[model samples]
Target chain A: MLIDVTDAGDPRLVDYVGLRDAQLRRPEVSRFIAEGVKIIERAFAAGCTPRSLLLQPRWLPGLRELIDAWPDVPVYLASEALIEHVSGFHVHRGALGSFDRPQETGWDELLGGRRLIVCEDTVDHANLGAIIRVAAGLGWDGVLVSPGSADPLYRRAVKASMGSSLALPWRRMASDSDLQRLRDAGFTLVASTLAPGAVDLAGLEPPAKAALLLGTEGQGLSDAWSAAADRHVTIPMAAGVDSLNVATAAAILAYALRP
Target chain B: MLIDVTDAGDPRLVDYVGLRDAQLRRPEVSRFIAEGVKIIERAFAAGCTPRSLLLQPRWLPGLRELIDAWPDVPVYLASEALIEHVSGFHVHRGALGSFDRPQETGWDELLGGRRLIVCEDTVDHANLGAIIRVAAGLGWDGVLVSPGSADPLYRRAVKASMGSSLALPWRRMASDSDLQRLRDAGFTLVASTLAPGAVDLAGLEPPAKAALLLGTEGQGLSDAWSAAADRHVTIPMAAGVDSLNVATAAAILAYALRP
Candidate 1:
């Protein structure tokens, strides 16, 4: 169904209203907004059901084939100015898709993976997304984010992940004690920490199954989480410098420890 | 010189005028703004000459001792609203400093280092800054960005670097032929490319002196730069995924190839 929407207040455009607001970031939100052409394509490729699409006419010709595949999906055509007005930001890449949230990966499926990234309160959307991207790109089987972490399917995260958050099997942990379950599953819990006596990452021989636990931005892995790890590893950094950003650190660790 | 500045148009704040403008991003710009208290402290630590400071009243006490040490440098106290008005953006970090651009690292000093990051048109400020941060944190000696790359001293880059840019020795290339100079210095030119048959980063033995080449966001390395490299290296990513972000790639390479 192709609908031309002239009014920014159109009730049908509800999915895209106030995109910059906090509502869309909530984990309970039923739909995720896929921004730009590439992410929208990835959303479809990941088998997400498209609820609707809001885009300018110039974006139509390129995306025509993709949208035509879903004939029942409403394609709301609007002007570039109206889109900027409706979304409360410039739709610079010039397309947006609202899709039903994909089902979360199950614990059994997640535990079967050889390698995983387990994030603790890694709440920054872009950083979390980058972690997911690197994890998937390097052939890591899945991601397990803490309860307080940002939603992987959120627009900013999806954009940042280049939609790898959709491609990878990620599940939000119910509680911190999930670490116990991982340990019981025959996986080595390696915590990235600054604690003295931590082994250098280069020297460590990675085990058959390992979960790399990353922490939030300011405070590193919480003391309890740090204590629970089977081993502690540190990237030996130069003197007088602060630690690398969490996402960058994840990339280095993921590359070095890839199964 | 403790001066309370009320008017946003005060002549003392000239270095901060229209901060969002392209002028501040230009390599020719004489001064750079250091946002937040930590980076300001880093600016002083890096021996950058403080031209002046624009900050809120609440922040004065904590920074008093540091500012008092440089009595000749004028401290412009203003309301957060006033600072935000002048800077054309909210100074949520609550402080700012205008510092005379530090002297660029010379070729002789840079070439003497065993590990270096050479960026080719890595123009995004935040990405370039992250590269510098990772390079420094991983103990890479210096950074050499191509002529077209963003200035390492640009405000956004400096902030993203978490003040590592202040501590690291980074210089911009005079021309494309600077790669030749690096090769002449006996530094192995390792190009991070996606090309087939590129040596997997896991297997390659990094030479003593190596300069890793990184490119821009949308495009990978330019053909000429890739061809000029002494060896091509790649992170073996999983099938069906786009490549890693430039900054993330830099982090992995800097760590793996660290001296």
Candidate 2:
């Protein structure tokens, strides 16, 4: 449905308003806003049902087939100025989409993989999404984020991942206790750390089923998590540098240890 | 050295004004501003001479030693709001320093390294910096950027590198012909590409001296450069994914091909 809107306060456009409000962007929230034409297309390709779309006419030709396939889905046509005025920020890509958030992969499926990435507290959304992109690209089966991690479905993350977060199998753990389930599945838990005794990464041959544990941005894996791992591996770096960015480390680790 | 200023338009503060002007931030510009105390400290550690310092009082105590050492350098003290207002953007890390642009490495020193990262048209400052950080962290000896690449010493690049860009050896290429110098130096020019029939990265052994060529963000390597390479190697990814982010690819390649 093509709905033309001139007013910023149109009741029908409520889903796109006040998007910067933290309450609306929470991971538990039922909807996520995909910000660009490519990401919106990815959302549809991944089977997400759109609640509505706000776009300038310039983007129509590229997205015509998608809008045609879903006649019931609201497609709000607005002038770029009105869209910016209403959204309170310029939509850089000039296309904004609101979609029903998809369900996360279940533990049984996420844990059945031969390779996995477990983020303990990867709070930065871009970092979390980048990790997912590399994990999926290199053939890792899934990703597990601790409760405190950022939402993989968040718009910036979705953009940063180039929409890989939408395609990959990922889930948020209920608590630290969920980690034990991986060990029960006959997986060797390897922690990426900079501790003194950890074996050089080049020396550690990955086990049959392996889960690599990554930590927060500034700190390496927490002591408790490091102590809990079946093996500890460290990337030897040049002197004077403290550590690699969490996402960069994930890319290296995922590629080096890929099955 | 501790001159307090209340005016946002103060004449001595001209260096920090209109910083958003691309003309001022150009790579050819004789100076680059370092935002935040940490990057400022990195500039100092890297032996770059300071032109001036702008800071709020809270950062004073921590920087007293360095301030005292450089008594001739003007330290403009201001309130946080004044600093933000004058700079036209908030300095998130609360301190900014203007420094003389450091010199780039010459061909002899840069090409003599056993492992190097060669960036071609990497225009994103953050990506360029992350590539340098990973190269430094993974023990690559130096970096050589094509003329069109982002400035390694740019503030965001410096901060993104966690100051590694300051310490790493990197220089600009006069033209693609600088690549010829690498070949003459016994450096194997390894091009990273997704082209058909390229050898898998895992199957190839690192030559005695290796140089990895990285391309622009979206289009991947240009045909000219890919054909210029001594060896074509690729990281085989899962189907449906087009390619890895240039920086992420650099990380995996640097780590795997590290000396």
Candidate 3:
């Protein structure tokens, strides 16, 4: 169903309001707003069903087939200015899709993979997204993010990943027991840390099935995860420099340890 | 020289106005603004002479010694609200410093080292900064940026690098001849690209002196640079994934090829 929305305050456009406000954009509500034409297309490509779409008419021809596929879905047409007004920022890419958030990847499927990235409390959405992109790009099979980690489906995260978050396999760990579950599935947990006495990353030979564990931005891997790791690795740094950005570090590690 | 300015429009406060506006913030005007307490301290530690400082009174005692060292420099004290009003953003970090932009690193000095990162038109300040941070952290000696690259001294870039931009040695290339100069100076130019037939990054044994060249966000590298490289290298990726973020790619290359 195609609906023309002239009023920015339309009640049906609530899903698109204040898109830039982090607190208002909730991915946990079983929905996420996919911004930009490319990202919206990626969401659909990833098999995410769109609840609705708000877009300028200029984008209609390009997205016509996708819209036709979901004839029952409401496609709200509006001018660029009105959509910008409704979203609290310029929707410069000219389209937005409200997607039903995909279900979490099952633990058995995630852990059954040969390569995995396990993020512990990685709170920055961009960082989490970048991690996902690199992990997927380097052929890592899946990602396991701790409960406190930022939602990969968040707009910024999705945008930063260049929509890889939609295509990659990932799940949020319910608790610390998830770490044990990974170990029980034959993963050799390798913690990326800055702690002294850890073997240099370049020297280590990863196992056939391995999970690279990364921690939050400031404080590194938790003491429990660090101690529990089958091995600890550090990327040697020039004196006085603290560390690389968490995602940058993940990319380097993923590339170095790729199976 | 201690000063208290109540008005945000004070002509003396021009350097601090519109701090968040990229077009308005020009480090090329012989000065750069350093935000937050730690970055300000790092600026001073890196020997950047302070022209002036706009900061909350609460931060004065913490920076007393450094401020005292440059008694001739104006220290403009303002409430956080006033500073935020002038800068057009929350001055939550409680301080900002206008410092003399340091002199460019000499070509001979930048190329003298064995390991280097050369960025060609790397326009994203944060990516450029992260590349610098990783290069420095991984013990790479210096960075060489093409004329079109973003300024490493940009506030966001400096902040993104965790202030490593201050301490790392970097210089802008004067021309394409500058790259030729590196080759003449016994450096192997390794271009990071997604082009076919490129040697996998892991397969190459980096020469004693190596320069890893990275390009802009969308495009991998320029034709001239790619053709001129002694070796073309790639971090192999899964099919269907376009590319890794340039900074992330740089981190992986820097770590893998660290001398």
The CAPRI class of candidate 1 is high
Candidate 1: segments with Cα more than 4 A from true spot: none
Q: Comparing only chain A of model 2 with the true chain A, what is the TM-score? A: 0.96
lDDT of 2 at B10: 96
Residues A110-150 of candidate 2: C-alpha lDDT, one tens digit per residue: 87899999999888888988999999899999999998888
- The sequence of per-residue lDDT tens digits that candidate 1 reaches over residues A1-259 is 7899999999999999899899988989899999998999999999999999998878888888888899999999999888888899888766899999989999899899889999999889999999999999999999999998999999999999999998899999999999998999989999998779899999989989999999888799999999999989989988988688999999999988998
Q: Stretches of candidate 2 above 4 Å error? A: none
Candidate 3 chain A has its poorest 10 consecutive residues by lDDT at: A22-31
Worst 10 residues of 1 chain A by lDDT: A85-94
Highest DockQ scorer: 1
Return the interface RMSD of the candidates, in order shown, one decimal each. Answer: 0.7, 0.7, 0.7
The total number of steric clashes, by the backbone 3 Å criterion, in model 1 comes to: 0
How far is A213's C-alpha from truth in model 2 (Å)?
Answer: 0.9
Instruction: Estimate candidate 3's alpha-carbon lDDT, on a 0 to 1 scale.
Output: 0.88
Across B116-209, the per-residue lDDT of candidate 2 in tens digits comes to 9999999988899899999999889899889888888877788788888878999989998888999999999999999888899999899999
Cα-based lDDT at residue B83, candidate 1? 88
Model 2 / residue B227 / CA error / Å: 1.4
Per-model TM-score on C-alpha atoms: 0.98, 0.97, 0.95
Model 2, residue B46: C-alpha shift (Å): 0.8
Candidate 3, residue A134: Cα displacement in angstroms equals 1.1
What local lDDT score does residue A145 receive in model 3, on the 0 to 100 scale? 86
